[model samples]
Structures are given as structure tokens and as C-alpha cells.
Target: MHHTIEVEDLYFTYPDGREALRGVNLTVPPGVKMTLVGPNGAGKSTLMLHLNGILRGEGRVRVAGMEMNEENLPRIRAAVGMVFQNPDDQLFSLTVFDDVAFGPLHMGLPEADVLLRVETALRAVGMSEYRNRVSHHLSMGEKKRIAIATVLSMHPEILVLDEPSAGLDPRARRMLINLLKGLDMTMLISSHDMPLVAELAEQTAIMDNGQVVACGPTAQLLADHALLERHGLAP
Candidate 1:
């Protein structure tokens, strides 16, 4: 009965006077797979940042029952894995193994445990063979998988991904989808891919202009063409 992710009256404004989130209130119970659909500049990415306290705002944000603040930022980040929109941002190590081991090592795990986590995570994403590959030389799909392995190594209770399927070829996208379906943690995905949403999310939330406009069962919302159109999610 516990909520894995919670935001109450959350508001975020950039230093340059750009408001991204407006009183966003939502909760995802443990182990639920949810999709966030929104057009450009809808604050979906901003909201994801709030989950791990990357971009703090005005209101209560909690992950796995821990309040997100400076004192608990480290633990909160360890518990909530975020796969950013751009794989380049996540993979920066000279080799894929270093990138995947970065989080666990930073958390100060034993060297043996860190290596184990890196191997297990890479294997989970089916990228174990690329352990020694340089990230800068990897293809887009390989980088994406390596990015995911970096977070998976942390063993986060909740997984937040932004545009996970973006810029991938059909085969790569399908492989990513299959990898997601096999995961067993709470997932919050922000994507405009309706087909992926329909296949992966049990619940869907529609966002626009920094607020959640409508949320409910995925099938019901997908069936409502008018609602999708109203939110600029459909043609």
C-alpha cells in the first residue's frame, strides 16, 4: 500500500524566470508502471528531475518514503534511478564498465560488490559483451543500453526514464521495449510514443503546460481520441 513516488503541490521555476511545473500532484504506488504523455515544453522532464532532487521546487517530494532534501539527497538518488533523455549525459566514463560502476562506487560499496553490480546490470540489459567498449565510440542504441545499466547497477526502487525510445531504430526500440517489460520495479516513463505507452503502461497521465490534465487507466485514455487531441497528443 506504499507509494513509490509522490509529489504534492510541486512547483518548479528556473533561475531565468521560466516556470516549468505548476502545482503538480501525483502518486504512483509500488511496482506500478506509469506513462507521462505531453507535448514539447510540458515540464515532464522537469518533473522527473524533481524526483531525485536534481531540480528542487516548492512542495513535498518523496521517493520510497524518504523526503528529498540535501540531507537525504544521496540516499534518495540511490533509491530512484533516472535515465535522462540524452544517453550522452549518462555515459561519460572512458569505458562502459566505469560508467556502469560509477554510482555504486560513489555510494562507497565494496569493490567486489561494485564489480558484481556492474556485471549484473550489464547482463540484465544484454550488454555484458560491451563492458570494455569506450562510450564515445558506441552506437546510439549501445549508449542507451549502457545508460540504463548505469542506473540498474544502483538497484533503485523506482525507475524514471525520459524519451527512452527516442532516436532508436525499429529493432533497437523493440529491444528496449522488451527489456523494460522484463523489469520488476516501479517505472515512471515520459514519452510521446503512443504505441509504446499503450504496450507498457497500465496507467497514463496526460500533461500540458506544466500540469497534469488527465490521468487514468491507459486503455481508457488511449481510447479517448478527443482527450488525446485536446492535449496535443494526437493529430
Candidate 2:
């Protein structure tokens, strides 16, 4: 299998002396949909950052067959599109169209190609009509959709999202799930919502104290009440 993502004994420590990731190892093969669930401070964010070369650490981290290093960062980031936990961080342009077009534009796409990518991305996220809307004025769910569109325009091989449905209502959350399901790229999602995880991911991994304690089929992990409760994922 072509593993789009791979990490072997990955470890990270904050400047303040906190070890956020400890000997973490994970693999997301092509076309796999994996969800990561864990208690707060379990290094979920740290690990996700490493995937796109946003944060470098000890050991091996590879995205789209390229090692996570200064030299490979640019290509790795292009291959792995990351939608942050905070939509505000991802959506900075004044207009939704601008925000969605940001990546493609930076990649030096022509004006026509950039606009086409923006439109296609918005359509994929069900936000086509809101392209000209002011990004800051949009609702939380709308902002989330636009943030996703921003990454989708890059045509990444793998989509990585952190807390995707964090603040959405049930109806909006369901719609987001459907939107994500329609995408063909491999996905790496970190979320506290068990139901969303169960529905979106074919594989699930439980993290605790900076380590992935368990990983298996989503159905089996979701059904193990005792295991989840132990890891603070009880639903």
C-alpha cells in the first residue's frame, strides 16, 4: 500500500520543557479515513502539526513519501492540507473567495485557474453561493466550511482537520460530515465527537499521555465502552 502518511517513534517537546509527543507512531495509507480521539494535551495537535511540517521533532515523519524536514516542508504542506482547530486561524482573507483562493494563488496559479479552484472548492464544501460574502461576518459553521474550502483549493492528497465539528449544531455537523464523505482524498481527523468519528472514519486511534494506546477498526473501538472511558472518550 502507498502510505501517504507515516511516523516512526516521533517525539516533540515544547520550549517550556513540556514533552507534548512521546514516541508516537502512526501510519495512514492511501485512501484511509482515520480519526484520532484523546483527552486534552494528548499531543493530538502537536502530532497533526508534524504531519504538515508545521512543527518539526525527533524521529521520522513522512507525508506523501517525503520526509518532514526543512527541505521537504514546502512539498509536504502542499500534499497535506491542514484545517486548524480554529477557523479564524485558517480564514484570514476579507472575502470567502479570496480565502479559498489563497493557497492556489500562492502556488502561482493564473487568475482564471485560481478563480476556478475557489469556485470548485466552495462548491465541494456546499458554500458556493457564499463566495463573495465577507469571511469575518459568517457564522461559526460557515467559517468552518470556508476554512475547509481554503485547503480543498490546494488539491491536497490528504486532508487533515482538527476538531472539525467543534462548535457546530447537529444539523450543520451532519452536513459537514456529508461534505467530507464526498471528498476522495485520504483523511486524518482529530475530534472529540464520538458519533462523528464512528461515522467518518474506517479506522480509529485512541491517544493518551502523548501515545497512541489503541488503534483498530472504528466499529470495534467505538463499541468498546470500557476502553473509551479509560481514555476519557466515554460518550
Q: How many clashes would you count in candidate 1?
A: 0
Q: Judging by TM-score against the true structure, name the best candidate.
A: 2
lDDT of each: 0.92, 0.91
Q: 121-210, model 1: which lDDT tens digit per residue?
A: 999999999999899999888899899999999999999999999999999999999999999989999998889999999999888999
Predicted candidate 2 versus true structure: per-residue lDDT over 1-235, tens digit per residue: 5699998998899999999999998988799899999999999999999888778889998889888888988888889899998899988888998899889999998999998999899989999999899999998899999999999999999999999999998888989999888898899999998889988999988889988899899999889999989988885
Task: Return model 2's CA RMSD, one decimal.
Answer: 1.0
In angstroms, the error of model 2 at 212 is 0.7
User: After TM-score superposition, what is the CA distance of residue 27 in candidate 2 from its true location, in Å?
Assistant: 0.7
Candidate 1 residues lying further than 4 Å off, grouped into runs, are none
Q: RMSDs, each prediction?
A: 1.1, 1.0
Local lDDT at 92 for model 2: 82
